[model samples]
Target: MTGAAERMRDRQMTDGMALNPAGPDLAEAMPPGVLREIEPRHLEEPRGRYHGHAGLLAAPHNVEEVAAVVRACAAARIGIVPLGGGTGLVGGQIMQDGPLPLLLSLERMHAVRDVYPQENVMIAEAGVTLQSARDAAKDSDRLFPLSLASQGSAQIGGVLSTNAGGVNALRYGTARALCLGIEAVLPDGSIMHDLKRLRKDNTGYDLRDLLIGAEGSLGIITAASLRLVPPPAANGVALIVVPDPAAALDLLSLAGRQLGDCVTAFELISGQGPRFQMEKMPDLRQPFDSAPDWMVLIEIGLPRGLEPDTALEALFEAAAEAGLALDGLIAQSGQQAADFWRLREEIPEANRLIGAISSHDISLPLSEVPGFIEDAGAMLADMGNMRINCFGHLGDGNLHYNVFPAKGRDRAEYDDIRKRIQASVHEMVVARGGSFSAEHGVGRLKVADLERWGDPARLQAMRAIKAALDPLGIMNPGAVLA
Candidate 1:
């Protein structure tokens, strides 16, 4: 098909389409190797808490094939559920048994299309993993700061779609903030190429922003232009032992005032968390004693000309004088800094391996964090039997409120009580003028919660947009919205 003809056809598909749109013949769409090559390794899968909703699906290698497949599915009225890495904790990626959906993965679109170093932007296909983008940036003496534990396999599209916020959110911002523009395939197979490197543009509507955290409910992101930053010249890392969360908050304000924007990371690690990790991971050693109750993993990164060490030293000294920090250790080398960060990043994984957990990713007002911790901790304990590993971007007041039950308890049994626990936590969070979800987007896991607690007018507007863009509701139906 000619480019213009293809584009015209795409536009036509968007019109007069039923909620259950008719699709092309699926038999001819499949290439020979696409399904026939599924041998032993392809079929062999690990036995885990597998979501029975959606079954396994193949990844598309290129945009043309992916778009074609989606178009055909849309025509057939099959729900198109976009997948990437399949590492989503929420039930978003699960293929449910009813109204069977076609899972379209961008894993094969793993290509670095272009890197515009001069413009401080890079264009990568949807399937390009986060680690690959970071490597590309490093090669050009720039930095792509959107990072997380799943970066090794988490594709750019999924990250941006979910609007993932990782460790560096304090400075560089989240996936949404890092993105310049996106190129996505609409539900009708139309390519909305808004990929531009301009720093500022007030065109009609910023359509790219709609798709950023849409969780693939609107369209399938094909490629994106991501903003980059200059590599930090110096990194100062210090793990401070604080008396409690209140003191950690105090130290955060102190460091923020003293260090200004250079305070890149202010991570709160429960004293019990590190103790758990030390016990779990034999190779990882504990840096401090077990009596502090709460510890702060603070980081300060400066530009090339600034003296990071001197600035950090001053902050620590002031913190000590105020009795906010009990003791501290500064990482003098890169290896030591990595160790400090590992302690913070691996907490969730470490806790997961430990046993049962009813996790909550919530955010509250910065001033209310300390109180929320103290009060919520007691409340959770009062509810029944659970231990809370409360930590996260303390600077931003986001807390990963994970509830781990007593050891050896069956987590499946707690599933029935999941709603009650979530309601308790969410009620407390909302009372503090906080959000139910902080970093993670409202995937299938939180859809009902979103409907209940979400602002009605806001939901109406979102539904209007969804109806306009994907009237068929074939793109990730029952996700983010009911």
Candidate 2:
């Protein structure tokens, strides 16, 4: 079907509530092993904030099988919600109120297709866990630098689909930068086999880039050719206590001046995070006897000849001399380094236990971060009595700005202003030239935010592209766009 006729048919389909795979036809058309019953895990999101609806489940073993499933759904006029690792925070994998859709799970397609150590490339299936992809790269003596706390469960497809940014993004960039190419099943049931290992392919249009961060709205990504780097000869991690947020920025600048790209990851951590951990997780080991107002977790990787310990120690000394650092603890062993990272990684879990009134994943220009933190804290103070935990990828300008109710009070007490708090914070972030959704994609959670703050021209172009690509409106309906 061509343009006008296709759009008209789409309109007709939308005039009434869309139907999911109902009678025997959808099941008969699907491959033998593709169909399965929906599970409780599939319907519930991580945060329990969104409960999705799916009439059927389909797990494709290969790209062709994926295309077949897409064809079946298209023929049946069924919306498709592609489920990744389910580690997404923004409710992108969820479809709550739309027509009963087909849940497309890529878990069965897990495979490390190819690895070229000489060329620093690894072809990985979308269903492969991020840790598995990293292991494959390690087996080939190359480093796939995309690192996230949820690596054990987060799949490559969702990571790329969300264009995820993690601790190492300051050095390695996002999932999009680590990827060279992708193979996806377009909305019309045809496969885009563009997973090339080339570094420079001047194709007319970059469909790979479009699909990477589209949150599966564009298509279902089947696999990717990922970029890899040579492993560093030495690595070290340190927790440097800064008196305040501005000092943390100064410390970052000093590290750049002294160590340059050797700094692999730099995370800002608020004392509130450790306080939460101590209150909720008593068994958690802490690096300091008392948590300072703010600290930065810095990891450095260096080539041969330079000792990581000496480099970190020298950097700390310089920072202390410059009045940017108060106290520090450098990891003496691999286990100690893991413990340091464990503390940072478990902050989110601690927050979950305490229960936040509202949480924001935001980013500001490096210069504005400290001021924003101060201003936003004061603004929240005016809005209500609460505690604020501000932490995240300090090197990359992203912060996990979260709000918690006052001590001994339940989060439900602030339910009246929950949405107001979120909006107020996002407004401040937007006014400061910062993004309210930093690494998290605009899933169902932030549809209104995108509409309110999104540039008109960009929204128009996005809608036009969505209409052009998936006129049937089956690919991840109501995600990234309303």
* Strongest candidate by TM-score: 2
Q: For each candidate, C-alpha RMSD in Å?
A: 6.2, 3.6
lDDT of 2: 0.90
- lDDT of each prediction vs. the true structure? 0.77, 0.90
Cα error, residue 161 of model 1, in Å, equals 0.4
Clashes of 1: 9
Residue pairs in candidate 2 whose N, alpha carbon or C atoms collide under 3 angstroms: none
User: What would the per-residue lDDT of candidate 1 be over residues 1-482, giving only the tens digit for each residue?
Assistant: 32322332353366554333222345356443332222232222121333533332546676666677777766676677787766666656653434445667687788898888888899999988999999998888889998787889788998999888988898889898999998888889887878898889998899899899999999999899999988889889998888888899899889878888888888988876776686677677667656357888888879889877788778888998999988888888899889888888778767877664577889999899988988888887777777677889887788888887665565666777777888988988989999998888787667767877899999999988988988776888767886
Global CA lDDT computed for model 1: 0.77
Summarize candidate 2's per-residue lDDT along 193-281 as a digit string, tens digits: 99999999996899999999999989999999999999999999999998899999999999999999888999999999999999999
**Total clashing pairs in model 2:** 0
